[model samples]
Target: MMAATDALAGVLTQMTGPWPVSAAARELAAAGVPVFPCVPGGKRPLTEHGFHDATTDPGQVEAWWRTHPDANLAVPTGATSGMVVVDVDVHAPTDGYEAFERAYRAGLVSRWAFLVSTPSGGMHAYYPATPDRAQRSWQAARPGVDFRGDGGYILLPPSMVSTNGATVGYRVRQINTGPSATLDSDRLRDFLDPRPTPPPTTSDDVQRSADVSRLATWVAARGEGERNRGLFWAACRLAENGVPAPDALDVLTAAASQSGLGEREITTTVRSAYRTTQPQARPSSTVQGSPRAADGWFARDATVRTSAPGRRLS
Candidate 1:
């Protein structure tokens, strides 16, 4: 029997993976990569949003390909594909390509899973968009190199480019498909998109966490009449830094209850605190009798989208 890699190679050969644009689009869409159309036989976007229009929905993919069967394919770079592409161009006369070589020789760019050879004699080195790397596109940060990242898109494989009846299509240059190949490479990330300063280390995190914990402890020790006022003050402090209301309620409610407040009292106090914090979201003074009213309050505030899991960013 053939080796697993050989088997996958054989399977790839049977399908039009990087061949006809429609087939390439279908395959990529199925693999969770959002695909959108560039102009048929050209490179401009067919949709208004360009790469933002990329969707993994099979039906949308089918519908798009159905309408523009010959359209060129493009996928959003960065987190959309869970990747960023380091584009090194041989066609350009700039020193960017040379800069890439220097960086590579310096033992940078040591991580990448696969690469695509572009029609213009350039290459797109694919690497995962590691969460901490802060991936974003750059043009000529070196010379002939570009980063196809947060706001960039890449021509999908098998999408043909032709000039004056001469055709040149992107083709796969390397394929391992192993876990190492598929995983994001932090080293390669540093080479392409180095942060000016190191990311914040654990010291700040540890201090903030300790501070919050101490505050929680103090709130939990408040006595009966002061329970609501204490909880409200604590919730406001948490909200000042954009902590999610639900989380603040969870922490402070536990604190309030230990101070002898009832469930209804705790809920009302927290809700009022949140409303006062977000005065724009405040409703009329009258109370509604809907059974789901409390739930509605929570849901309305659920619009707070978190940057980190426990905290929202303003």
Candidate 2:
């Protein structure tokens, strides 16, 4: 198979003017680049399996276009096409160009093979794929930027899309004359949308975590008749106090087992409690800051005196 750059160059040579979608699809396939047909004037794939059905065989390419001659041209991203794209979206009041510009300035997105102007006034920056590892596709919706890599596809030039009641083609904007480089998709995404910093853990948070152990011990000490009901009530308190279902199950499972509860029964009871009370659960922040809120949740059942119940700390 031809390298992606050479194949791209071959496709570019054939794109002198407004070429037909069938011819474009044929040229791409002939260049060793897999091609597929999409809905006319749109990005949605027409084939049953979508991008997975993309093929480089000239015969298959011809059959696809013959059936849907006006269909838009699409190519799979990442290793399938040996290329990846940074899609800069242009939804009104949420344009991604500013975020992209920031990434460019930070040296996070400096090496692009080419640029394509999308019908929606956005841009697509193409890059060579890193051969050593796969880069999965992802989107930073808040920043309005998306990465098209493995498991994603993009429309090619001369393929028109309906935008704002007007039809426009995905036209070539610029070609890189110098060395083209692969993109660090992970770095780019982190730069565009940094994860929030976690709040500092407090003393109360420490107490809350320790309290869970005590609560479990209390559940294990429950007498025969009260075993199931005690487990249910403990699970409900954990849920209302914002303890994640998994953690609650982990702590409660062993304790409930000690009280003769079966594995299935433990899981069912814990899950039921989470489903019933989690929606109305107080936020961790509220529970952590207010001693009364934490105390209130534990006070709901004062019978577990020896090992007092408490809100979960995250």
Candidate 3:
């Protein structure tokens, strides 16, 4: 998901143009993404307020640059600019590119996208912001990656920051010249900020998973009055999830026996429950159902989509 640090800054090496911060600001404002100024040779905002002072006004932008000709260009993220950025420090194999790779294989980031080469040899992948609530800035999702979402901003192309007594600037590695539209970030959030995996739901771990264990215990504790009903319900739960009828029957029988259900009643209840839950009647075809029958059963596949297809990233 990241290029080498050498290649990171190389993203903008071919540039041959005037370092006109004001002109760049005008272009961004014309694109409808608001802009602001950060003190040149530094990232401190020139405006009294920080990102909140971002403006689309050409006059303000001209005046600000006129006052401080060397100020860097910063764009507020979130709704105003309609974008979020994934900040990747190009320290692969050191900081956490391996961790980032794991997330990437898990489908965390889009391979082809626009990015801005950062001043500190980092690359910022830009994604259109989703329409929902603003996402707050996140620090170090992995060792090398950070996120600038809602309530945050990024110093943009043609913006210079000082390093090693010299000036380095951000440049558009991938340029978006079309109408800005949202990029689906549900996958990014889920992958970067994943929930811990719960224990598996294998028969061995049936007791390990709280939901299955609770249901099993509920069946095993039923008394005479509730014995058949409990066994049927529990068996039904297993069968509907395509547990083999025999496996389901075996579990229900053991639990019902402990609950004082006679053998005949246990067999009849389990068989009837299985029949209703598994319409195929054959146990061989019982491998198709919900949570109880999944690989990483609690795993949810998040939807990923571009706001619009064919939007070029230059």
Stretches off by above 4 angstroms in model 1 are 1-18, 95-97, 177-314
Q: Which residue ranges in model 2 land beyond 4 Å of their true spot?
A: 197-314
Q: Candidate 1 lDDT, tens digit per residue, 1-314?
A: 11322332333344443367787677667766678888765555566545667887889888888998888887776665666677765322343445565555465543454556566555666666665455655444324456666656677566777744567766665543443222234454456545567457698777867777888898877764576788888877877766655556546644554454433355467667778887664423312111211223211112212122122112
**Local error of candidate 1 at residue 265 (angstroms):** 62
Backbone collision count in every prediction?
A: 3, 0, 1
Residue 160, candidate 3: C-alpha displacement in angstroms: 1.3
TM-score of each: 0.52, 0.62, 0.53
Which tens-of-lDDT digit does each residue in 1-314 have in candidate 3?
Answer: 12211222232333346558777787666556678888776665567555677887889988999998888887776665666777665333333334344554565654424556565655676666666565655444224465666556677667777765668777664533333334445455556555556665687666434555576678868754676788888888887666656545535544454454433356567778877876667322111112211222111121112222243221
Model 3's C-alpha root-mean-square deviation from the true structure amounts to 22.3
Comparison by TM-score, 1 against 3, better one: 3
lDDT of 2 by residue, 108-189 (tens): 7666666776766667888889887878776665566778777677888889987667898887765555567788898887
Residue pairs clashing in model 1 are: 18-158, 96-143, 96-144
Question: Which scores greater on TM-score, model 1 or model 2?
Answer: 2
Question: TM-score for model 2?
Answer: 0.62
User: Per-model C-alpha lDDT, please?
Assistant: 0.57, 0.71, 0.57
The TM-score, computed over Cα atoms with residue i paired to residue i, of candidate 1 is 0.52
lDDT of 1 at 55: 89
Candidate 2, residue 187: lDDT: 84
Top-lDDT candidate index: 2
